[model samples]
Target: MSVLELARAEIRALVPYSSARMEAAGGATLLNANESAWMPFGDAGLGCHRYPDPQPAALVERLAALYGVRPAQLLVGRGSDEAIDLLVRAFCRAGEDAILVQPPTFGMYAVCAHVQNAAVVEVPLAADFTLDAGAVLAAVTPAVKLVFVCAPNNPTGAGVSLEAIDDLARRLAGRALLVVDEAYGEFADGASAATLLDRYEHLAVLRTLSKAWALAGARIGCLLADSEVVTLLRRILPPYPLPRPCVAAALEALSPAGQVAVRDRVEVVRAERARMVVGLGALPGVRAVLPSQANFLAVRFDDAGAAYRRLFQAGIVVRDVRRYPGLQDALRITVGAPEENDRVLAVLGDGA
Candidate 1:
C-alpha cells in the first residue's frame, strides 16, 4: 500500500512534455527557443529575457537545507496554492477520486478540488477549532486520495494536536496522502510534520515564505514529500514555473542575514499577538479570543458586522470570517506592527 498507488494511473504512465529549455543548456548562441535578440529594457541583475531554470537548482538546494530535507525531496512552485492544485491534479481523477478537508480551514483545498471536478469530503473541526483525529481517520475511504490538515489552521488560529496528526498519518498509511499545510509553522510552538516524513512515506508538508518571511508578494512555496512523490509533482508542474527575479529574491531571503532578520521580526509579531489578545479581551461585546499558535488571532465578537465597520472606519483592515462555517461572528486579524495593532486596540476599545 505505497503512496504512489494513490496517484492517478494516467499521470503515473504519462511522459511529461519536454520544453525547448529542457532540451539543452547554455553554450554559445541561444537559437533554440524563439526569443528577442536584445534583452528587455530596465533589466536588473536577473536575466528576465532568458527562460529561467525549469526548476532553479540553487534555490532548491537552499530551501531543502532550510527545511531539513534532501534537495531531491522538494518541489518548488508559485506558492502553496500551486502545490495544492498540483496535488489534486496528480491524485484525484475528476468525478472519481475524492479529497478530504477540515473546514473553516484553508479555502483553496476545496477550491482546487472543485476546479479538478473532484469530490470534496469535509470533516468539520471541533467547536474549539481543533482536529478530531479519530473522526478524520474514520472518514477515510478507498476513494479518498488526499487529506488536507492545516495546523495552527487559518482563521481559527488553533494548532491541531501533533500527536493526533501523527496517529492519523500512521492510520492512513497507504490509504491516502496526509497533507499538512504548515503555512503558519514558524509561529507555532511545535515541530513540523516534515520530521515525520522519514517514517510516513505518504506524508506531505506545504510551506511558504509568504507569512513569517515577509515575502507574500514574492509567492514562493515548497512541497516537501517523499522524493518519489516530489518527482511525480514535477511531471505535471509547468516548465519555468519560477521567474529569474523570484529565484534571486528567494535566495536572498534564505541567506544568513535574511534569516536573522526574519527571526527578529517573528519575535515582534509574537509579542504583538499577545498584546492584541489582551487588548481585545478587555473590549465589550467581544465573546472570545481563540487561543492561537499562528501569527493571527481569531476573535469572536458579539456583533461581527459592527466590529468590522468600526475597524474599517478607522482604516484598519482585518479578515471578516463570518461567512466561513462556524465563524459567523469572527474576524481573523494578522498580528501587525506595533502601531497597527495599537490602532486596532484604540478603535475596538472605543467601540466598547
Candidate 2:
C-alpha cells in the first residue's frame, strides 16, 4: 500500500474544520461570510471585513523570492507551531507512528507528537548542544515518520552542523522525513538549510517572521519542503489561515525595504547578544555563557532558581531551561534593546 493509504484511517477520513471563509465562492457579490461590504472609516479605515486569501499568493511569491525556492514548495501558517502540528497530524498514525526529536531544544516537537497521539523518541544533544549522529541513527525505527532538529537551537542557541544534518537526511532517506526548524537561522553566519531543499526530497525547513522579520504579532511562519510534501501538509491546514490584514502586512514585510529593515534589526540584535553575553558573564553567580549563533544567549548560573527569581523580581523575563537535559542552571535570555539589556544586567549585578 502507498504511505498515504497506510496512514491513519481516521486522518484519511477526517473532515477538517470549515469556516465561513472556506465556504465562500469567487464572485463580486458580498452576501456570503456575513462580512460588511463597505470599509469602516477614520482610524479603522482598512477593510478587515473580507476573508483573506486561503493561500496568500503575494506573500508566497515574495517568500519564494527571498528563500530562492519555488512558491509551490512553501506553506505559510500561523507560526511554526501550526506547521509542526499539521505535519504530525498528516504523517503520523496515533499509537503506531512516532517522531524523533533532539532535546535541549524546542518543546513543541514532543507536544505536537502527544497531540497526535504519536510517541516521541528523544536523542538528546551532546554536552555542547550538537547532534550525535550515532545516537540518532540508533533511535530510528520503521514507525518513525519525522525527525525534528532545531538549528541555532532554542535554549542553547547553537547551530547544528550542516554535515550532521546532511548525514541524518542521508541515513533517513526513504524511512522518515527530516524536519529542520530554522527559526533563528537569520542570525547565523552562514546559509540556511533551505539551500539544501533541492537535494533532499524528505527534508523540510521551518522558519518564522517572529525572530528575524520582527513580525511576531502578525503570526507568520513558513514551511519549505518538496512540493509533494507541501501538498500533503496543505490538505490539513486551515482554510483562509492568513487574515487579509496579515497578508497585506506580511507582503509589506517581505518587500525590498522590509528586507533591509529586517537585516538592520538582525545586526542590532546580534550586537546586543554579544553585549549581553559579556555583561552576563561578569556577574558573580554566572558559571558560563555558551557561544550562540542566534539572537539569544544561554547563560549558566550558579543557581538557576535564584537567578530566575532575581530576574523576575526585576521585571525581566527569561526562560528557565533547567528542565532540558544537560541544561541545568541555564537560562535562555532574548536579546532585547540596549536599555532593556542594561536593566537586566543592573538587576543581576545588584544581587536582586
Question: Best-fitting candidate, measured by lDDT?
Answer: 1
Give the RMSD in angstroms, all C-alphas superposed, for model 2: 2.6
TM-scores for the candidates: 0.98, 0.92
Q: Model 2, residue 2: displacement in angstroms?
A: 9.0
Query: What residue runs in model 1 are displaced by over 4 Å at the alpha carbon?
Result: none
Task: Give the range of the ten consecutive residues with the poorest summed lDDT in model 1.
Answer: 43-52
Give each prediction's root-mean-square deviation over alpha carbons: 1.0, 2.6
Using TM-score as the measure, which candidate wins? 1
User: Which runs of model 2 end up more than 4 angstroms from their true locations?
Assistant: 1-26, 30-34, 40-45
lDDT of 2 by residue, 153-193 (tens): 88799888788788888887877888999999999877778
Q: Tens digit of lDDT per residue, candidate 1, span 1-352?
A: 7788999999999899787688868677888778766788988757687888878889999999999999988999998999999999999999998999998999999999999999999999988889988788889898999999999799799897678778989999879999999999999887888888888989999999999988888889999999989989888999889988888889999999999999999999898999889998889999999999999999999999999999999888899999999999899988999988888888998998
**lDDT agreement of model 2 with the native:** 0.85
- List the pairs of residues colliding in candidate 1: none
